[model samples]
Target: MKIELAENYGFCFGVKRAIKIAEDNQNAATYGPLIHNSKEIARLEKDFKVGLTDDYKIFKAGDKAIVRTHGIQKQELQELKDKGVNVVDATCPYVTKPQEIAQEMSEKGYSVVIFGDDEHPEIKGVKSYATHGALVVTSPEELEGVKLHEKIALIAQTTRKVEDYMKVANYLIPRYKEVRVFNTICNATFENQDAVRKLSKKADIMLIIGGKNSSNTKQLFKISQENCQNSYHIEDEKDLDFSWFDNKNLCGISAGASTPDWIIQNVIDNIKSKIS
Candidate 1:
């Protein structure tokens, strides 16, 4: 069997930069997991003694605190600073754009609509910036009965699928008088998803490597599964079942933006070993 990797997979600029920020600030404590990968968090904890905590109340003065790439609520960050915690912001620039847009739109008297999961950390952070608070919608149907202002602003979580966001925008544009759409999806996310869509045509089986909780990884897995029924989302080699690859002549590999090259390599090596 031939093994091929996706055109764009593994760590993106934001994730690589976030990991570097954690490494540079040894003995620091991130406000949350710096990124979504558990193995990478464990590596940081073991190698640099960087701890992870989601609560701002527990952090003390003179201690270092790194903001997650998904960012945090504005009030929570302010509270951390007020407590004299040395803050090292590792928020991805892509995630910050939507927050700024949400705040500005709300300030201008426009009702804001975010196309993403309400419970996601990024969405929570972005919603806090909206002056009038924003409506979170995962689909166009979610917007059906919600009352809206004449002027409306639309944005999406950095990792959500482009098509899904567009679906909501398409539904709103016709109904709303003035609609402003910001393509807030990260460039890396677009590339990864596009690459998976391309890989779906050539491979018999697909392995998507990333943490189960990773949104971007889940998107890739979903995109792949839609086109190829033999797709599997696995965190690492341990999750791989040999039977999935049985009689498969070609296998494709893809990883989320948060996934490190080492994990991808290990999974690739393991898959190749089983092939023979």
Candidate 2:
């Protein structure tokens, strides 16, 4: 019986910074959910006076607000500042890079086309920074009705799969005269997927630990499932069904970008407890 683990797994730099910011500013009422993971959010809620607001209007003077790792638009941030809220910006540098790129490209008269989930907060933030019209696309199939402008720029969500972004870029490159593609996918995500793909080859079953709503975590699950049919995505130890591992001895564990190291350690400990 062997338990394999992905070489690069758990919290990425962005998630780490966001969590730390939320934790350190416990004296003030923290505004907005820190991360997508419910478990982590719950832990913060228990420790600090966290404010759950759908809009930034709830923020007041002397209140502490956490700029999530995904980030917010400049205007929204300015509004927060004007309202006299103390903002702890935890935006991931990789995610922030795309916003700056979008701003620069848009200023240069390039119609920006971002390859990412439109509903994602990160994408929304990136789009808001575009001085020119910004379009979001989740797949190459969505390129059918896209109209070309003279100058075009393409960037991807930081957690997006590299192959998916490349495919989208390849599809758009033929139609536009001037197309600039920035492979904005984070290095951590790339390395994590590579590790999962490699681990899948040897493990009998794969256990992915992360929130289901997390984009990067979902990507990891998708990639692992493709390679190993027995792969399972679970948020924590409670979701683990030991029956699945009854006949399996060699299991692999991997987590999403939003998953904290403590959660991953807990899952590992639980699994070991059951096996022992």
Candidate 3:
């Protein structure tokens, strides 16, 4: 059996930036999980003393509050600032682009349409920026029969697949007079997806590693599964099932943007030990 790793996998620029920010601001609390990987968050907490807080109100006036990479709702951010908390923005630049686009386009009287899961923290924050409210949908069918303005501004969650986002855009372009589509997908996501897709096709077994709640990780798994039926999404080495690799000639491994190299290496090491 052979083990192969995807060309582009593990911590992306944004996740690396957020990790650095968290390290620099020891004793500060992030409003949400700094990134999707719990193990990395635990590592930061243990080493840097950085804390996680679900409620923004818990911070005192002098306390430092680091914004999560996914960002927070506009009103929640404003409220935190109004309380005089020392705010440190660690929001990914790619995520911020959609938020700005939503706010600017909505103010210009364009109906905002976001292609993403409405319940996702990134989408929730981006949607909150739309002055007149934004419609969130997963597929082109969701836009069916929905009455939108003549002019529409479409944005997507940074981690969503470009193909899916295009389906939403294609649906609107034919119906509306003017539809402005913004490519908000992160470059790292594009690379990781493509790499996994390619690797999965050649491997007998594929492992997509990252947080279970990570949207991007799930996307990678989805793509891997499409190409290779024997695909599993695992957080770390602990989640590995050795039986899956039985008689498998090639094992492909890809990690999400938020996943750390340490975890990926651990998975590789464990697999090597078990199969050697």
Candidate 4:
């Protein structure tokens, strides 16, 4: 059996920065899971005494609070500061860009259209920045029956595929008199997805490592499946099924931005042990 790895996988700049910030500021609690990977979060809790909390009210005066990489709503952040919580913001710069854009464009009288999951923390946070009405859609079909303004501003969750954003942009551009589109998908996401797409075509079996709830990891798995029928999404080494590798000449490994190198190495080692 042969092993292959995606050219760009695991520990994106934002995740790395968030983890380091949390680690350096011991006894601080993050606004949420600092990153999507539970393994890394658990490690931080155990080693650095970093904690996680979604409710800002729990943070008392003088308590250190770290904003997760996905960020929180603008109102929530303001409340944190008003409460006297010592905030160590770790919001990814990429995520911050869309939030700023949403606020700026919406204030300027543009209806905002964001292409991503509405329930995602990033999207929820971004929406808070919009002063005008905002629409979140997974597909262009969602725009049906909705009345959008003649002028529109478009952005996406940092991890969402640009192709989907493009689809939504195509729909609005023709219908609206003026449309401003910002390709807010992070560069790291594009590189990772492209790498997986290329690797899956050549590998017999594909392993996508990351948290089950991780949006970017799920996207990678979906992209891999498009090119390879045998693609599997795994959280860790324990999730690997030896049967999947049987008679496979090449197995490809790709991980989400939040996945740590240790987790990826364990998956690789476990695969080698099973195949040997």
Q: Which portions of model 2 show Cα errors greater than 4 Å? A: 29-31, 48-51
**Over the full model, what C-alpha lDDT does candidate 2 score relative to the true structure?**
0.85
Q: Assess the local accuracy of residue 22 in candidate 4 as a C-alpha lDDT between 0 and 100.
A: 89
Estimate candidate 3's RMSD in Å. Answer: 0.8
Ranking by TM-score: 3, 4, 1, 2
- Give one clash count per candidate, in the order shown: 0, 0, 0, 0
Which model scores highest in lDDT? 3
List candidate 4 stretches off by more than 4 Å.
none
> What TM-score, to 2 decimals, does candidate 1 have?
0.98
Candidate 2: tens digits of C-alpha lDDT, residues 172-224:
88788889988899999998999999998788899999988888888999999
| Candidate 1, residue 19: how far the Cα is off, in Å | 0.4
Instruction: Tell me the tens digit of each residue's lDDT in model 3 across 103-173.
Output: 99999999999999999999999999999999999999988889999999999899999998999999999
Q: Model 2 has how many clashing residue pairs?
A: 0
The C-alpha stretches of model 3 lying farther than 4 A from their native spots are none
lDDT of each: 0.92, 0.85, 0.94, 0.93
What would the TM-score be for candidate 3 when compared with the true structure? 0.98
RMSD of each: 1.0, 1.6, 0.8, 0.9
